[model samples]
Target: MKKLIYSIAVITAVIQFYSCQKLDIAPISKFTEANYWTDIDKAKLMLNMGYNQMYSAGIMWRDEFLSDNMVHTYGTSDQNSIRRGEATASLNLFANEWKDAYGGIKTCLVFLANVDRVPGMPEATKNRMIDEIRFIRAYLYFRLVNYYGDVPFFTTEISLDDAYKIKRTPKNEILAFIHSELDDIMNRGNLPRAENLVAEEKGRITIGAACAFQARAYLYEGNYQKVKEYAGYLINDPSKYGAYQLFQYPAKKEESYFMLFTPENEYNNEVILDITYVPNLKYWTNMSQMAPISKNAEISADNPTQELVDCYLTMNGLPVKGTGKDPAYNENDPYVNRDPRLSATVVYDNYKWQNKNGSVDVIRTAAGTNTSDSYKGPVERQTKTGYYVHKYYDWTMTPNNQSGLNIIMFRFADVLLMYAEACNELGKITQQEWDTTIRPIRERAGFKVAAALDYPAAKSQGEIRDVIRNERRVELALEGLRWYDVKRWKIGQEVLNGTMHGFRFSGAGGDTDGGYVRVNQYKFNDNRDYLWSVPLTQMDLNQNLKPNNPGY
Candidate 1:
């Protein structure tokens, strides 16, 4: 549980940029460049450090706050700025992404540069470690390119002189390198396939993880062919992608899909890669506190948006027909007959959560629904958006909930969803394709009704594309992929630019927009907000990263 931390130790006197901090400090005095990497265990420790830093801090929640999934009430300045069309460059390493990603990339470069020095290890073990570092490096750059369009790119360790002279590389070129790097790791490197890995190495990258990330990167580039190829690699063959299958409905569990997020089901086949944590160690995460229940006496930050709630399909696999539409939905019984995922991912009125003792803690958000109890919605410390996030809440660690629950970065269900999207984009989609992927997801979500489980017939690419996208939203809700999705789809202007809304706490509902609260107006300046600008201080340090991205 003891984490080893390191710095890249580059000798530089020039003004430091966020991406290029003094690469020479050993956070722990026990290890330094002179004595470190002298043994296999030491080298492995550094590699482990890379995994620790790879997606630390805000990377998990950035997708939700930066996109339309959550209505931010209290959080970081970056979250507020990104939502308000005013992301400044001062928040760099990534403006909206924060400083941790570049730090992670720096850690990888340091490890890749010195890992070979370690002796007494089998060549296979060393190569596997190197492969893992390569994957982390590629993944970090993947994040960089997604946020800052064309960032200064480098693979090897560089002096400040060379660093200052380096200009931003084209994003497509870096993306291509990310793809090739992942491909090399999966095809050429000796990383154990997911099915072959031991319990201790459960969260590490495997061929399936590499493939899933590659498909995701290609998806960003609009490379439908490559997306289809990589996703299909995982979808068409289970053995090839770690024998992944949906977590089936458990009779005793409150909800079938919720089981996947519980500690008892950690590292199930459905998960491709997860940012892991350990209890009573440096790895235990406080993310659970961000989405605390009303009575838990924790900070309430991430409130689920009404926009996201409506994204789920009705039980009939059709849009929730609002009043005046065919087969109009009744507002009084809004949660009934809805997509099963709605109850799984969100904590709404009357949500049944679990306790460590396996008892159900019914969450009553309505006013008078819990008049005698201290825990009720629309009260102080309650969610501003009328809903709370429950997707990754660790019930066992509640109250003093510093959870060891791993935050999933990529999973097989995402690959299937990606495959469905890619196939639809390529004009090769069919009802059978939906049945293969989307149907199973809903069915495993406890949707036994034929209307919700059956695939739709005879739809064009555009229609199915929406279906696939919405399916992705509901299936992966609150897992922090929504921002990237909106960016890649080029729909930020449409989704993030309106008046955000939620439920009426006063029981005054009459119309669709009635009794709702206006949270904030999310402004998206299509001219520049899509790709954030580099830090102004960084640009000032090195003029090479010139012309801050558009409106900045």
Candidate 2:
């Protein structure tokens, strides 16, 4: 298979900043004039630029640190302020997010404006490209509206007259537009499935990706029917989705599912859509700094919170401390006989790190050891919560920490979880529904056959909902979905409040975090923290975006 490699020149975004006083009669550069869009190839190049412009590696990894999943150890990261409840209207992170999203929309609009000018291209390919632009535009709007509630909506490059005068469009309206856009494309677009794409087109938009994004948009709307409809299409009609089953190959039981994160498995059957990275072309993130067994070049960040650790169900499919309906759990050896995902997701006390040789490096998170390998002793940048994210570690990194690991943005496992959630919400979840969705995900995570993955005959809807939700958290841990899920479920007030705990470390007083060595108290201001403050600069540029997200 060919890798999606973008060695082409990056297109200058068509939407110039509002600060620019005047538009030049013509673009001084060759990239902007009629020469560029005269033919098929350059137009495709413009499309590729939109793809590159929209993606953010930070969203894939570091955003998880903002949620309860991981705490910022260094406190210098952008999300640190937001995590501490001190986020303001001028926070650059939120502002940049707004700019990038709208800028992406701008890029797509530019492409759509000129796509009709490209001549002598195959109709199928050209139509597919247009469909992709539609999907990308919808996706950007989805992110924008979700993050900041109301946003300036536009389908075309903003003219000077409309520029500063454009008012905020409600989030619901944006979502409705997204649904219609997705509907038209899915019904009429000649989009390929994951399996249908050539290696060079591996990262191109697909029907499955469109459906996945549409389903997610509806999930945010709390429209269970739309969620079930779209997700069920992908789940039931496997051929249409290129047969996206959970990647369950026969391998070592502990590590079979772990291979999903490896570069070797790029664009596999289960991958719905992934942001592709090509070495020396468009390199992706090097998580070696954050997820490594050592602090060689950089200190680790986003240390997995203990609360996240406890979310993984026991091997017998019970909580660490059993709930009202679930069986009692083993507190003494909570990590043992638990979900196989625990071993795959977190670097726990005494977790194994495979060396290039057949030897293994054991991770010991005990607090008081002087050993360099210990989480608290010799290392200055060890896991803050006594655990590190083991997923997406990119074991194949070069000595200097260069890696080309493509971030899997959407996978079939998420589709299954969505279906399960919608099913439960719609009061239609049954043993059969479990078999199709949640059961397979848990089973792939190393649940024993006929064990916890087995359908429960009599569980309340609330109990079933929690099981599905927790299943989502455990299965998608460290993938950056937990942050959105916490917000979407409106449980951030409950989850993000109080003292966040790390592993039980044997330590006395006099530390920066005080006697409670691993506790970091996070504040979630439920009254207004849900919707991020719109960037102050955006308002300064265009007051039409004013009355910023209430309480900004």
lDDT of 2 by residue, 181-208 (tens): 9999988959987777776788788999
Indicate the residue-level lDDT of 201 in model 2. Answer: 81
lDDT scores of the candidates, listed in order: 0.70, 0.73
Q: List residue ranges in candidate 2 displaced over 4 A.
A: 1-4, 8-32, 286-288, 293-297, 322-332, 355-358, 377-379, 449-451, 508-517
lDDT of 1 by residue, 264-380 (tens): 888877888887766545344445445545545366666787788878777666676443232655666577778778877777777676666878877766545652222233334
Per-candidate TM equals: 0.89, 0.92
The TM-score between candidate 2 and the true structure equals: 0.92
